[model samples]
Target: MGIRSVMLPAAIAATLCAGGVARAEGLTVGFSQIGSESGWRAAETTVTRQEAKKNGDTVKIADAQQKQENQIKAIRSFIAQGVDGIFLAPVVATGWTQVLTEAKDAKIPVILLDRDIDPADKALYLTAVTSDSVHEGQVAGDWLVKAVGSKPCNVVEIEGTVGASVAANRKKGFDDAVAKDPNIKIIRSETGDFTRSQGKQVMESFIKSVGGKNICAVYAHNDDMMIGAIQAMKEAGLKPGQDILTVSVDSVPDMFKAMMAHEANATVELTPDMAGPAFQALNAYKKSGTVPPKWIETKSTLHTSQDSDLQQIYDEKKNLGY
Candidate 1:
């Protein structure tokens, strides 16, 4: 089914209604995305556009291609264009204060999507809509612990981009989880830069250094990296799900496909419908002069083989441009 044909969740539907047609209709918003870095990011962009259309609003998107400077320029452009609000998925956690101050000076309410910046200038933006990255990592790690039991396992980790808040929080959460289990240990850890090619390269080097037989499992920061690791294991003549248990965050459609094929063990979902809640908050703010909470947390659902309708989930997500 197409994205438009898919039914909105009851809560989201209620949120849309709560905004009221009169308050949300014809509102112009600018969205600055951090480029299509992975399937999950692409889904977020797609869902943002879909939500905007559903609410009778127009969204002008600027793809920053994973650069903070580009995002800053986009925000300035949005300010010059006199948009009602701006949605930003920052590429990094710093250097946003001045540009956000400009947006604030222009009287544009800025909403952060998926990522956040330094808190020193938190007042500049209206609110941040994002999932708890630490929680997502904890979910993945907890699943791995349960699946491995008391067996001694050597795990390899494929991390996200260096210095990214998501990467740091995820690493911290997984470390906190595994710290409880002395039998489970991570032997190799390296950055994949959140790209499939880089993930594959890092995994290849890991396989060479540790040898596939010595490695017990692989934990990636995201599904794209996990998918890349799966390919590396296959090429090295290792059964991914059997010989080396696989787990990661971001329950994208491709990860579901891997799970169905028994190439992956588990994944934690980072929902893409951030814009729905953002628009709801924007509408409420515009209608009643009410200020929303500084942070709005989205769900972090976990998916594994036990889920009966993997194919159905895949079908739904595939149409969302994932």
Candidate 2:
């Protein structure tokens, strides 16, 4: 679906137009990022800053270091500084009500990037710009189903942080998709905390526990973890793409590079340009009083070795801090 089709409440839409175009020119926004936990996140941060710069606005960023408390602190600080708007990539889905209410009371429009908070506090934010993570997982699962055909496969999953909404939803989607085929079984699962180092470490343990030969496939919630899993597979004297078919989310540059080398299978893209639509929606809201949808779904395109533009994709994404 197109980004502009997402709809938000008309009540909150009015707040976005208080100062109009003049205020948007030098718009000072505070972005609370979840930290550079993975390449995807780093790219998100890079794109967010770039989007802010493109709009002739200033963005003050606060790195939450994957801590919800840090994010809460940053949001409160942003409110104190009276930033025109706040962009939050919440580390978790809960405990955001009080601080978000504070931002609402201060008349600051808060936009969520890449993830969504609980529906209970949905009214506190202007809108959320994120991909349908469940759809991404389903895409990954669907690809694996087609790749494996009727073959019985033992799959291992490297998940994101335990409590993160993205992790939960992606897992659910994958499970739902694979449920259709009894031959596809997830034998082992663990959280990699969405970092390459953690993914590698967890994968090392998985390799040891599951044994290199019994595994038929591996699924990671993000490409970073899948990349780490690839290294572990290589070290274990197993060819990842050939021996244990790999599928993952987040079409980061390295995934394409892995695909080019025949070391990985497929990845679903989770666009880092979340801020692009966010800024556009904010501008539209301020300029024409448009109420953007509460949820802006980004593209969830799947990429595989068959894709001809691997080099181009890698080159384009390489400089995005991934």
Clashing pairs in 1: none
Best by lDDT: 1
Model 1 weakest 10-residue run by lDDT: 16-25
Encode model 2's per-residue lDDT on 15-80: one tens digit a residue: 544434336556788899999977778998898889889889888899999999999999987776
Q: List the residue pairs that clash in candidate 2.
A: 6-293, 7-293, 7-294, 8-292, 8-293
Each candidate's TM vs. the true structure? 0.80, 0.78
Candidate 1 residue lDDT tens string, 75-182: 998886677899999888888889999999989999999887885777989999989999888988898899889999999999999998889999998988988999
Tell me the spans in candidate 1 whose CA falls farther than 4 Å from its real position: 1-26, 37-39, 65-77, 80-82, 92-99, 204-211
